[model samples]
Target: MRRKEKLVTVQLTGLTHKGESVGRTEEGVVVFVQGGVPGDKAIVSLARKRKGVWNGFVKEILTESQNRVIPVCQHFNYCGGCSWQNLSYPAQLALKEKVVIDSLTRIAKVSVNSLEPILACNQEYYYRNKLEFTFSNRRWLLPEELQNDVIDVNKNALGFHRPGTFDKIVDISQCHLQIDLSNQIRNSLKNYCLSNNLSFYDVKNHVGFLRNLIIKTNENEQALVLISFSEDNQSEIQSIFSFLKNNFPQICSAYYAINTKKNDSWFDLQCIKVYGEDYLLTNLHHAKYCIGPKSFFQTNRLQAEQLYALVKKYAEFQGHENVYDLYCGVGSIGIYLADQVKNVIGIEEIPEAIDDAKINAKLNNLTNCSFLTGDVKALLNDELKSKFGAPDVVIVDPPRVGIHPDVIAEIINFAPMKIIYVSCNPSTAARDFALFDEAYQIERLRPVDMFPMTNHIELVSILIRR
Candidate 1:
């Protein structure tokens, strides 16, 4: 237990919220292993310690976990995209569910009468609807590549960023998260850029033509590719767009954005439609949405359907109730539940998201749903309640920070009969649930697996007034 910066054998027993594997020393001191799984005995380097807890990473797996399996991807060892790909699918689900239960029991000090089983995703791989890849001049070479006798000088990469490095990117050839079409599109683009002598972005120097590429798809099998360029070369942009349009006729739309900013956050960046349609059609159950290039929809489409179904089930709507969807990005949940509820008034802070929400609502021909753009903390007030009658039910699918404290208080003041809470982070959810403990009682809770191959857990809880 006193070991630090030295090799020591440890047994990984659980998984942390940040996706690190949990292990312990012989003296019962906890050690977080980066690439370890439960039932695996491994040599760890306790490189850092904080708040009396040890943090380390696996040096070698002395004994493999029974649940561990061979990763499907060749770059799984170094790629930051997946954390639990080494563990079996069933084992991953079990660990996630355990994390939720542990968080709620310890942080919220609450338990449900009906702890419904965690919902498993039907499609484990290729379930994601969207993926954002970065372009870097300096690529992180794979272990096998480094072992080769002849060292390749090509360092340009167009894929995911390395886990711990900011400027290094893993040159992904075949990512298992999205459909094979995405792979084909990505590999083709990379090949075209490399052959045409296009410069990949240099994060440190802010030089290069290609910056990022986001490939998105809908359940309808339509595809959209949005490329970001650090330099606005009109001729090059036109040529690239034309190449994609001609080569990939299956793509419904293709857009490009010129982002010269130092940071690569392109959510607010304006994108120009260079080819095909303006938007792609994404359908969830009966709700159909017009997904723009920058719209913030759930990454996993099929699992989102399952997750929303759990939300509806927890809502237990009676066909005449008014609902409030706080933090309603793109208003997909509100639109999905519009038919069951008398009215759904959603409030969000992002203007573009609200715009997308309005368009989606119009596309669905839903008159019962309305979306407003503003701070949820400031907008969920009595004036709003007067304008739109008090929400009979509040369905909150908040960001990872969970709902704000003021918003939580306002929901308590409103005293809805039922609250359907959908959360992406379990630790924050447990803390916020504790805030509502006095006003409501937990009737049931179920964890939904919106993301696989990672340690993120989505939970849906049904709270009834005491």
Candidate 2:
């Protein structure tokens, strides 16, 4: 038996972190409604009812919100890549800033007078330096796009997956997030695969020529890595490699990864260099960095420079202060800041990333910086205090999950003079802010628009020991 649905008018309060509207019933039961912005009165249909939480849909927009904007992409509603497309760019920045502040206060237990002006990307579109597309047979079909042969897609360079459909993919010709070269490379590869009768990877059957496609670019240099699920034959592999090298001469590094596994693990796959070089090298500001097949580099290089500048400005180097960079990949930040400080120590979990970090340090001729490959928690335990002692300053550039609880405890125990927390996820950063509340005070919260045309934002916060 279906439960009776209840209709309610919600006075839209503000935007939630996920870009949904915050609303409540007369009984004060909180509700989150999609497609409704802040300050918009809407009639919503409650879909799910629980003890104190409710999920619903915006049945009617009773009042319009001034911050709403026309989404540029046609697949804005269905695609999983973008959430804030319907909101104005200025409004997006404002909401992002507010989210960061709220997270710090609510999660980190820290208060701030005001956040610094959000760092807006110079290029709102085509800013992503890298893109990864998944492979699947099931493709989504719109009402007008449905046909007899609409079930399985033969070949596709599907840009991204839909929100909840695990098997279905959204085939996109051009993604505004990446540069023009990515689209060109994608189109060229798709055409080549289709013409040669190459079979794309079938998620159900677990057999295919191509498993994943990754494209990265920095300045004028670009690198393309094709990850194949199974490459049992050498001749067929070399044939595709030769064709790519011959056609795309501009590709600085052309390589292939053979990942033969039921899962997405590519740890054992050999990186076969087919063309120009094994890696692509580029300069970020005054430092040089190298990128291999698996090494992680920031997607937005120009905006990254701006972010690094902010880090440098806040460091207030006395010319001999020692700095520790947690979660340092390729030692980019440590190497860049080597000259400004006495010595910089970097810690990362991945040994490959640590190897690249050391190589990059050597490439930049920065002998003062050293990278250690080990769990940050253990390093912070015995080595950090015994060998290096407490750092004069520390930089935490953690992933989306934010800093580990142990690391947070270590930082509080050590109590550095200045600490910089760089994060890709604002909510986690806000949570970590509360954890650091016992010791540090928030000095600045700056949000950088690394990924434009999407809801994702990069936030860098500077904290000082109380």
Candidate 3:
């Protein structure tokens, strides 16, 4: 016989990397509770062990945390995008700050002399410049709809994937992360598809015509859309594109792709443009970025500008320093600091990002900035340094895994006077700080809440040569 279900009452006190609340029982057995606030006393069900820790959700809240607040989105209970929305914005900032401090003290085991307060974002919602939606035939039923209700004949969904479920998606009526235009366009497309009998993608069998929709909005109030279809059906594609143009004039450009592959990865696929303009434009301070269909740019515009300002202030550019931007995707940071520096040389692995970087530099009429496309670890050598000159200030914005140890050794060998490290993962950043202990010392560190209502954070630290 199957074992009987067991329940535990846990006092949720902290957070995990995925935004679940961390709690403990009387015996100090740790519990990760979903739908839990930091200070909530909740009865957690679905109690199951996974890799030695208990994972569950709050079945009943005996006591509410002071930091708890009403979530703005109706689907907050189930949607995975904004798990911290129920927690107050101030509380969210505090939690992120705690992540940094804990990682440094426990993991890095280094004492930072100065750590600034977390910089809160201006907007709590609608701060994202881009959003991607998937089309799935398996839709996750709502709590109310599952109570002795029959499954509807229609099984169409066009929204985010349900948490922990790869095949099923939650049909979103409204999303709060992007502008209202995004909402209208998404809803209109879903309705039109259902009415016109265009089938949604079947993840299990890899059958159907509709696959995905991506919407990118800009500070200039123009929108760009990309539709991914399972196969190339020209007549149907034109009909859909025509419908979009007739309904939403804000869509300045549109593109569609034919993806016959099983996976949703589109970087290798070709995207055909059937609309106006080649890219979207975003003005970041003095630099105007041309964000193409596949280019990577900062999602939060307001906070990105503030973060760049911090980079400039921390570098303390003297107008005669040669700067090296390592892993600089699209050269956003390097180009922004071009005017204040003698010359800036950027290195990145992706050729497309480097192409965009060069385009952006030329667009801004910046002769001092140049970009190279190659693996940072392979390219940061004596030959490259001799060609571009030794860096006075080194700026690195690596992936979440942080800089590899080999790359760290090379940066130390360069022996730049100043180092600026921008990180998205605090834990990895802490690990990296430990590696840099001997050569450089962290002068000052600041955390920016680039993604509000979520646990994701960005931090910029200035390191001085010891």
On lDDT, the leading prediction is 3
Q: How well is each residue in 1-466 modelled by candidate 1, as lDDT tens digits?
A: 5334587789888877777788888777799878788899999988778688888888889999999898888878578688888899999998888888888889999874457889998888999989999989989977567657447679999888887788889999999999888999999999999999999998998999899999998776679999999878999999988888888887999999989899999877899999888999988989998889999998988888888888898888999898999999999999998989899999999999999999999999999888999998999989999999988899888888888888899999998999988999988989999999999888889999988898788989988999
lDDT string for model 3 (7-112, tens) is 7888888898999999997678898888999999988886588999989988888999999998999888777889998899999998899889988899988775
In terms of lDDT, the poorest run of 10 residues in model 2 is 147-156
Model 2: per-residue lDDT, tens digit, 352-423?
A: 999999989999888888799998988887656778767888999998998989999998888789999889
Q: What TM-score does candidate 1 get on C-alpha atoms? A: 0.95
Q: Between candidates 2 and 3, name the one with more favorable TM-score.
A: 3
* Candidate closest to the true structure, highest TM-score: 3
Off by over 4 Å in 2: 1-13, 20-64, 147-157, 265-268
* Count of backbone collisions within predicted model 3: 0
Compute the lDDT for candidate 1.
Answer: 0.88
TM-score of 2: 0.87
